[model samples]
Target: MIRDNQKSQRIFWSCILPEPLIAKYGLSFAACNFSFNLMSGGGFDKVYSSLPVYVGGEMDSDAFADERFELVYDKLRKRGGVFQKLAVLKEQWMIFRKIPRGAFVWLYNLNILNALLFVLLKVFRPSVQLNIIVLDFTPVKKGWGANSVFLRLINMAHGRICLASSPLFKSQNSVVLPGVVPQSKEEIPVISNPKASFLLSGVLLKEISQIELVLKVFAKLPQCELHITGTKGDEILLEHYAAIYNNIHWHGQLPFANYLELMHSVTFQLSTRDINYPENECNFPSKIIEALLHNRAIVSTIHYPQLNGLNYFEVPSDEEGLINRIQEICELSKSDMYTYVNQGARVREIFNTEIWNRQMAKLEANK
Candidate 1:
């Protein structure tokens, strides 16, 4: 239903690439994060910051609500029911019918809406380039079929798949693209408070009980404090823990700037998950990278391949192991702390956003 003038030239780069690249090329991006706002600096912010971002989703908001967002949500809303299905079938013909074709069209996720959109984009604008960046194939609880089918459809469309992890490349059209960060370090004062505070970040509900086990272990550490960085007011855990533990402090969800600033003040960053779940085991926690970027020592569970031996305590499923590790970290000498911080710095450099951008540029050129 929406068609652009053929002669009005444009290049569509999909995926949440760095904002600098988007500004440099004057490219438009399709927004995929569930939220319409561009606050978080990871996926959605990277795209929404640069291009004429298309905000297509189940959510609704006034397109002109704030010039800061510059959004275009609900492109497919009731209009996409059956007519869109027909358009997908007649994709190539639709491209032939369109006026001046686009240079390239980028897609991020491969869900129901995206699959239909890709088909229509191909059919109506066959002459344009097609690039796809896959952050995750399926939802955390969902299995591989959703992703597998999406990759197959992408291959059929002649679009290339870019990934941040290895599991995304089961298809021929898939290409591995490393995720990046623009992290700089400062000499942080050692958190020498005898009561060492461990700041835990994430929505607590996903794995609340596992976190409770962690809390149980630390409760016994008389000289330790626990600061939880997520779950805004009225969480069940907040009410329950407040009564039981005098040492645990729930700061709720702080703005990212404040979160990073708070990270500098904490003694160590902590993450825990139930590895019995396949999805949890395979996940790459962004917080881990954030902690590393700040040159903070970590206490996290052993899950992903990249987490091996980075001074992160290999937490066992039981409470005793967690307790023992915390005790060991509590007694570490200044030299031991320095070695751990140095190791975290090495990992942080590998994920620097600037380094990631340069690598992506090279890959794009060679392709």
Candidate 2:
């Protein structure tokens, strides 16, 4: 039953609910992103919606969150185990039955033909808004199985499209609503020897092979204490780095709140991603911004165009260049660290909350 005059009442925060939104508005979320890590941010538990919530992904297991549908037919194979798979399928059926009529269905990276078919079915139904928060445009290309013509047609049915970065929105129909980062004027605790402490976070996706390079660089810099976080990849490259470099400590994926807590303990930070993925070029790593917000100096590749004024040191995609950059930072005087701090303050504005709030309000007003 579609409400003919549905109130502009719901926000349908369909993607991973950022902490700021829950802290500010406390709106309900759809929690429809690909990974569990994306949804574990601050103040998440407090924002409970009586409205229906739907999560669509490869596995139907409720292991991620409360409500979700399985996109894959055999989410559990012999490799994954039979008992585990049957449990997942049962959970999927239950979640499918509970989907609310007027709820929002969000898609982060949907390239599957079956996923699109489900979206089309929802569009034809009386209710349900197809809101999308476009992260990157890689999936719609040829190899990803996303038929270009079909994607364009389905894109037409979207009730609203919010882009993570300005470059992501090529068509005039989309508007930018980059994720928000809070400004902090409070004194940040300083490491006794700022150059000696280092932090690393973000998904250990295969594209991030640069982490191995950074680990090798840090191995040579004995003074630096490298703290690496996030789940291990199948490759386990970090294990090799650890065996070779005893100083490289692996603190596997921490909960969102705990991760922020750990940031306070380190002085310098790392956000290295390989340039191989086209997505890496335009997309800003939210973890890097979080480090900036917490007043940590960053060492990352020269990828994101917006990281220009920050206290960031970028090197070539080789180990030698990365080693030299790390050495240069370690050799800088205490006064130099302060200089970097001042530079970091300027970088904070790139993802300011006030700017995002105002931009989002303007878009809503026009609608």
Candidate 3:
């Protein structure tokens, strides 16, 4: 869409990105975000300071309210009360202040604000090229459909600025980036042993009450130890279900290195979601991908349709169905079990940095 090749462009992002990877695409980037904590944690300072878009420090609720940014969040949360509606006009004030006209911005999360902002750019600042990279699509709230006007507007605005990070996203406007998976330093020993461990990683969510069903099933697997990882979410509700089980271990959150190291040792992985969507535009359990990379089998729900052809044990997100499938996976033959480890090469076959570069090349073509 950028017909004028003579103009210069820089990437301005508001999300965590792989610094070294995104660096090759543009000369610099600006990390402008509204965070509640200092950006000092991790290598964020080094990554953000490497560009001009970094917004110095975190922005609390007061700072967000000062610019009526709270309204945008309210809209996303689907809970804009009487007070929020009165300040809708002030949303523009926030936009113009944060994003200058005629700027090139690569927004990481295409939330409620960015949808309206994209429209405003088209109407007010035609020169500003807005690209959106979608890594997460787990709706601000459950039951969110892609047909919504805000999401439709974003899809309409895509002209080389939309990149999908997962196959779950299906719009002509976007292309899924073959995301980077951590490569083991050496050949990792694949779990050929049946009497081994199980790993479940992610923040526990209320909508995902199916996790309790998984725990119940895990309790039955006396020979296998279940390891849960990641920060956030309430695991206490399932404590009663797990208390009777000695094989269940709550590892909480581990460093990136430690998580993957543990992932490689697990016998199989579990990915389940209690809720179903009318649309398939939601994230698959990333644990499936991790299990695949480590050459382990997986027990998953329908959310991960890519593994439909593979040897994974698929079940409904219900208590009885989960127990049945978990038991089925436990009873697989040596050939069938090994097939689960060898099958499902889709991620490696299609998703890679090259696919990402090729998609970015479409934008670079105009440049």
Candidate 4:
């Protein structure tokens, strides 16, 4: 239990819970889960004495073993129906009421649920310091004009904004977070596969075209194998390619450990997110960070100014460019491949937990 004196120091952190909870709920997104674990591992819980208030899914009390971070979830919403929305609102209100005034609160994303919480805290508990961690930005397009406007309004409410990628609109209060490095217990040695093996993992629905492009490229390269993982998006489309090409394998939503194991075994971590997409401007491919931490070489089309110095093979967002890059990597000698893998080690020093803690400390001091 938290001591009374520690009340003001306590941080109420709201995000999607860990991978197990996400998998249990059948949620399609896992990037937030990766970020949450990185935050916890990087000492966010210990530094701020944080209490995790989960959004988007029901909590499993017995699932998590971390006693340091208490999990809060809406129980009534688990019943599910027309009343679920009302139940969630009521639960959010109750949670907000319980928060001590002048406390620090860190919210993970800029979704509708968090937008409501921002208004509630701003109006009712004005002293509560609020920070929004933007993992992905809603694209400002013709159909999404209202959402973009709403997001901007919500941004105005934040005392400070921590962004994973560059926001479309600049804000004095906002800071682009140095990407988190996943904690590794032991160094994972780069696997020297005679036949190049590539792993592509993330939200498949958003990058269906990119995935399809990779599938077509892999179909021609019979010697190289491509492994795809994440929640199912278009099963029929994926299965169609998987059927035609024995080298292309799709594993829909593997356990976190199994996913990491697969990543470790692959020759390169593949990211095919189109750099031309407007949404890409506001979001960073977190998979690149994970690959770097594991000492694996990355072949990616997505590039941002923040990742300017990172060691990764940049490819044009096209089939010919991807195929050429893959073939080039495949032709590299074992010694040269090892050198490429070792280059990723620089990421560990560049984006360490110490840097993360220091940034968080600065944010806390600003309050």
Highest TM-score model number: 4
* Tens-place lDDT digits, model 3, residues 1-367: 1224424343333433333322332321122211111122111111111111222222233433332112122231123354344333344345445555555555555554355556777777777676665544554354556435545554544443322234333455555441334322445556656545677776565344255666777777787688887544565744655577788887765655677787877777776665465222454444565567567777667534344445676677767777676776777787667767743345445433344434554653443
**Stretches of candidate 3 exceeding 4 Å from the true structure:** 1-12, 17-105, 112-120, 138-149, 159-170, 176-189, 192-196, 275-281, 303-311, 342-346, 363-367
Among all windows of 10 consecutive residues in model 2, the one with the lowest summed lDDT is 43-52
For all candidates in order, the CA lDDT equals 0.51, 0.51, 0.50, 0.65
- Candidate 3, residue 274: Cα displacement in angstroms equals 2.4
- Worst window of 10 by summed lDDT in candidate 4: 45-54
TM-score of 4: 0.84
- Candidate 4 wrong stretches, greater than 4 Å: 1-7, 10-12, 41-68, 142-146, 157-167, 191-195, 206-209
Off by over 4 Å in 1: 1-70, 74-106, 139-148, 151-168, 171-178, 183-195, 207-209, 232-234, 307-311, 342-348, 365-367
Looking at candidate 1, the ten consecutive residues that score lowest on lDDT are 29-38
Query: Mind giving the per-residue lDDT tens digits that candidate 2 earns over 99-142?
Result: 45655444443333224334443655446554444544443434
- Model 4: lDDT equals 0.65
Residue 85, model 2, lDDT: 43
Better of 3 and 4 by lDDT: 4
Report how far residue 349 has shifted in candidate 1, in Å.
Answer: 3.3
Residue-by-residue lDDT tens digits, candidate 1, 94-161? 33233246444445445554565566656766665555655444334456566566766655544443
